[model samples]
Target chain A: MIKMRLLNGQPQNRISMADRAFQFGDGVFRTMRCTGGAIEFWARHYSHLEQDCAALGIVCPSASILLEDLSRLRPVDAVLKIIITRGETARGYSVPDQLLPNRIVQLAALPAYPEQLYQQGVKVRVCSTQASWQPALAGVKHLNRLENVLARREWHDPDIFEGLMLDRDGFVIEGVMSNVLVLSDNILSTPKLEQSGVSGVMCEVIFDAAVQHGLQVEKRAWTLDEIKQSDAIWLTNSLMGLLPVSDLCGRHFQSHAAQLLLSGALKQLRQKEKFAIVDLAGMTKG
Target chain B: MIKMRLLNGQPQNRISMADRAFQFGDGVFRTMRCTGGAIEFWARHYSHLEQDCAALGIVCPSASILLEDLSRLRPVDAVLKIIITRGETARGYSVPDQLLPNRIVQLAALPAYPEQLYQQGVKVRVCSTQASWQPALAGVKHLNRLENVLARREWHDPDIFEGLMLDRDGFVIEGVMSNVLVLSDNILSTPKLEQSGVSGVMCEVIFDAAVQHGLQVEKRAWTLDEIKQSDAIWLTNSLMGLLPVSDLCGRHFQSHAAQLLLSGALKQLRQKEKFAIVDLAGMTKG
Candidate 1:
């Protein structure tokens, strides 16, 4: 399937040597989990992609075209990555007068999840690495992720699990690649991303779930002390769904309310969430 | 000449879909200018590239191997770019236990320089964008350069010229891609890069020249307020050599004792500097 896919896309592989994305880290991407026979959160994923592309003034490709291309590699379920970068430029910073962003989408097998760890949440710790404050680029999932790369490098403990990151101002931001939610005073609260943090897809699901269930929700600057004192804490992401924080540096107390809410939501969603196979040949090249 | 260059040691026609450079910005690159068949400052360029690769734990191709690829290009004088990225990762951040970093050496004709602008000097302005302080990555030239991209995006005023960047704490650091030196009270000073900024090769030369010419040379933190009062300011880089800053925003400066001494030394060295290109085929690829 992979060989044939490459052979067919040969004609559409005309990337100019001076595209700004290749020249500068000017792009955005989305990695969707296609399970069963449908794309998980397809609307939300493309919405975020288009929003970010527009924020950076890059042209976006049509979603139906992308869907058409994805129809070729149908094999139950797979992982799909879509990249849209600032298009060709004549070796300069100013985005050209007329812009047609280059879009490249690729497909791969879904990574096997560590189901054992998910049953009993993995050990989590706080990382020393801090994301710099940049309101100009806050919230949207842009391709400039060196902060996450550096944070991901902060740990090598195989026995350990996901680590939380804080901003330079000491505000607990989010996880290495996931979103965080705190159940404090019976309220669902997450850190605000006016300065920095990837606005996550899973996070939107959690928020919507809270709204439908009539749970009080809040979004604002959150400190480490506040998070530790919260009745319960959980991490959220499209890949991991939702995992309750069982142990934070050995201060273990199963936030009874957190366990109830997180478990209930995960159970309700997992029952409906399914992955689909992607057809690589049908993918459109921007 | 570039089309013949192979990808992954094969006669590939385009960049691979799985190249890590495209996926994660996981790479390091070096660009050098060759004049009259010889690459100026080859040793300095190689040293900086090697140090960065070592710091990032990226594999380093031997100088001989690099030259062999260069010899294949056979350009009398050209702009060469060397990009070595974690080649074919399987769609995740975890670098494989056994990884083979890919090496790409591209040669292009050099663009014409504005020598007259150098002779008359140029104007520069302080950019609103601030550089994030990453202590671990302060002095190395890695592929992650969004800060430079953002700062450079501030203007295209050919007359406005380069923009100076300040650290989060508002300390004068350097230009978008060049280092700045200020002269006052018969002393020449540049900002230290222990916390941020690329330690430019030209900066080291100017520091040594200051000592040889009997001028006080300083490297430490100073605010924009201090820089505004300097008698003379200049920008230095491997490509631009040493050029004076005639106008900084609303402020104008004239030649000073320290800049005079530094300029005189650079002029004499350029006259005596011997540049000889070695056969690229002679380079080793360990």
Candidate 2:
């Protein structure tokens, strides 16, 4: 599908090659979902963007400016991507004395996935590519995502939806594109991203929903064996929402009541945001 | 100075916002020095680029194609940056079923530095930021350089020529923009990049020069304390060739005869490549 892009609040398809984003991946980005002409959890996404920019010392554009840029797009079922870079610099890692952050917002048709996979759950594999330890960049959705790209490249089988990545120390960190959650004995535990992994927005929503539903939530390190021992496993992200994992590294999991509870809570959260459920079953071809 | 850029063999200043280089840093790059309309170490740089692209499974552009693109620039004295990305993709980490790599080559005026730096050496500091361990990406010079950017940001003092980065285990790896070399007991040693750090082309040249000059060379892990005990230290890169380090973290070193031997050998290596000496003393302003 053709994509529409806005560069710095203008309808443009290209960015300067000098942009630090292209040069050094000196930036942060967000992949957001848009439904019924409104962005889902936009305030949360913007807050996260600001926090990430602040972490890198990049000046984030004001929310009103980004809102106006988003408003310029034609309201349709789509995915909105926001990239904020440290603008252009002359051949150096040091930030320029005077710098302006470049903001890019693009809209593309929502990717179609097999609806059956969502219902039956996806099969995931453990990727050999390990996420590196960088506490300063941990939990921020920055654009230095070659690790994710490499992890996703590990499997090409259409049957597999995502690949789980472990840290160098063999601790289950996250999925290539999503955050992982494990349920065991009425508790919801997700990997602590203090050292690595991207702390996803949907993962945040799931944590809040679990707390509201009176489920104990623990954020700590989990080995692959420990994760496989869970009563249920799921991956959460902004676009995919919550997708239960049916199989991980040959270990099978059954859909449990806890899955439904969290799913129902997420549905209510979306409904409160006026997100109309788009029937994606018809669009699932592959 | 305004920089001239070429995208996909065409003179262009911008790249598509969807370009994977800007999105995920799914690419590799080479920063080369150009003198009198000839690119220095073109063969070595191209070979490294090909190796890096192959490492990521991206098709490397033919040497002839890149040469044709580089020839378009009116190369006075400049730094030519070549970035090859896995091209544009939809909104995901998975490589597309059909993919085409994008090549970007740009030229900018060479940055001027104090001539005293080459003679008296530079003061380097140990960065608080540590390089992550990712063997998959080790020595490739890929574009995911947020780690370098963060390290560079850790110091703004003009006196500091470069920041030394250690691996997660506190083993000295490399400088932010250069490779680290140590001289001890008439033996030259550099940190092994098997686990991390960019395997610089100039570092390779220095190794060859050391062997030609009959100097002992060792590639192994060395701690910061161990590095300080060295007779002398140096940083190497394509642009900055074999710069001696007079002071590292306030530990001063006298100019040793071993440094002069290596420096003279490197000078002969450059002369063999027909790289004319450009007097940069007059250009040093700040």
Candidate 3:
């Protein structure tokens, strides 16, 4: 298997058993798409990671060193998985007076995705398992993900591509791992990440693209009822770009202009990436 | 440090990086007290572990083999930690079809408790953090414990022994890791595990002891108000036999009866343990 190194700059095949992430799910992570030896949306992804680490009191990894490391490991095209844990060797829950937080960066081959599904869209299931809201941890891709794991385990059919999740209060938080956005009245509305939901890397890109492309974005409680009248439903994450939904819970929707435009924008971005790997060397972050 | 086999009974220095438990808090655990080389209340601990396994669909460890391993790893007085994760590999939100669920059991030197504190009592702080209610995982000691981990990090003082945790809806749930009980007017009420709280081994022992001793065991929602008015407040767990709380949020209580009685009963049971271990000689769980 291809490998990676711990942030201490050690060549390691395994992380310590006592790592806070391994011990208590005390960590946050980001999985980004890297093509032509360049990562997509490096600034937004690292910024979200820094914000989450700050919120959770995890030490932030320096972006310059991280980019340099990733540059070495980047293949022609691959997926980069970065995990920043609350460090190893913490006794119980007490954050040490001093912490050398550990970061792990792994390069892996991107899983094959159905390109046609982006055009035809995918089907999703509404899981009975609900995401419990913890305002302290909401919107961060923190490692405490049992709710998503439980929801994902509810079904085992390859036919069901993704599962949409809601917080215990019945507000649609997001998906098991990705962010959710629904279109209605020519306006695109995404669930607010203020209380709960992973503020995904791709979601930020879409939000930025929306503003640049003259599309409006709203952040509010997008309930299951709002889901019914929605024009188009789509899921976003770094790996699967933007996946439109053809059907959700047996209800069907047709193609829309925004979807095609969004798809085209992503394609253009992909093509732009093919030429120049945009600089992350001077990006400001925590 | 001494280490036992992995959950799947494989030998490993560290658990897999992709193990679901480490990744998503997708597991359950039981902590037991070993006196004279045998865990006190072994059957009840295993039963609770099995209950948690069933609740989360994790593979239950073979009781006899598990116990036998425990017997091998015990010190004359020790603390045993049995963490049973979902036994599935790390695949983000997905629990893959092929799973070799893992159990990691480790025995450490028992914590030295202030024997006099049991007689005089300890004090507690009411933490501002609140536990989220999730009925799907209520009562089980599953590892989605960011709440407990967060609260545990709230304080660190030898003088300040424990902290009280409340649910988001304003009901007292438990201590960071132990179960809580209050005594008022010849009636004892413990927070209902219906929503969120670890159904602890020692908590179960005390409940059984209370029932056997003809005490009213009311399991329901308990609030801070009821606790302040309680005749006595007590904490129960394997590591802590029974700790009487002198005060909670500055309100003092004289809750020594239930605490002493429960401790005395458990002490008597631990005096003879060779014959007390669970008889897994012929039982097959899987």
What DockQ does each prediction reach against the true complex? 0.28, 0.66, 0.50
The 10 consecutive residues of candidate 2 chain B with the worst lDDT sum are: B277-286
Judged by TM-score relative to the true structure, which candidate is superior, 2 or 3? 2
Best by DockQ: 2
Best-to-worst order by DockQ is 2, 3, 1
Candidate of highest TM-score: 2
Pull out the clashing pairs in model 2: none
Off by over 4 Å in 1: A1-19, A72-76, A89-94, A253-255, A266-286, B1-13, B255-260, B267-275, B279-286
How high is each candidate's interface RMSD, in Å?
3.7, 1.3, 2.6
lDDT of 1 by residue, B1-286 (tens): 2423434443333565465666666667777766666766667777888887776667878876776666565556677767776566566655665688877776666756587656677899998877766665678776666667768878878787789998878898899878988886777899988767787877777877788777789987878888889888889876677888888888887755555568778766544452455444334321
> For every model shown, what is its TM-score relative to the native structure?
0.87, 0.94, 0.91
As a whole number from 0 to 100, the lDDT of residue A92 in candidate 2 is 80
User: CA lDDT of A220 in candidate 3?
Assistant: 81
Across residues A52-115, which tens digit of lDDT does each residue of candidate 1 receive?
8876667778886666655544534666667787776554355555777777766677767676
Q: Whole-model lDDT, candidate 1?
A: 0.71
Q: Docking category for candidate 1?
A: acceptable
lDDT of 2 at A210: 93
TM-score of chain A of 1: 0.86
- Give lDDT tens digits, candidate 3, residues A1-286: 2345444544454766677776688888888888765777777778889998887878888987667556555345777778888887623566676787887777677778877888888888888887775666778788888778778888888888888888777888788867898888878888887766788878777776777789988888988878867999999999998899898888897877798788778777665543223343223221
Better of 1 and 3 by TM-score: 3
Chain A vs. true chain A, TM-score per candidate? Answer: 0.86, 0.94, 0.91
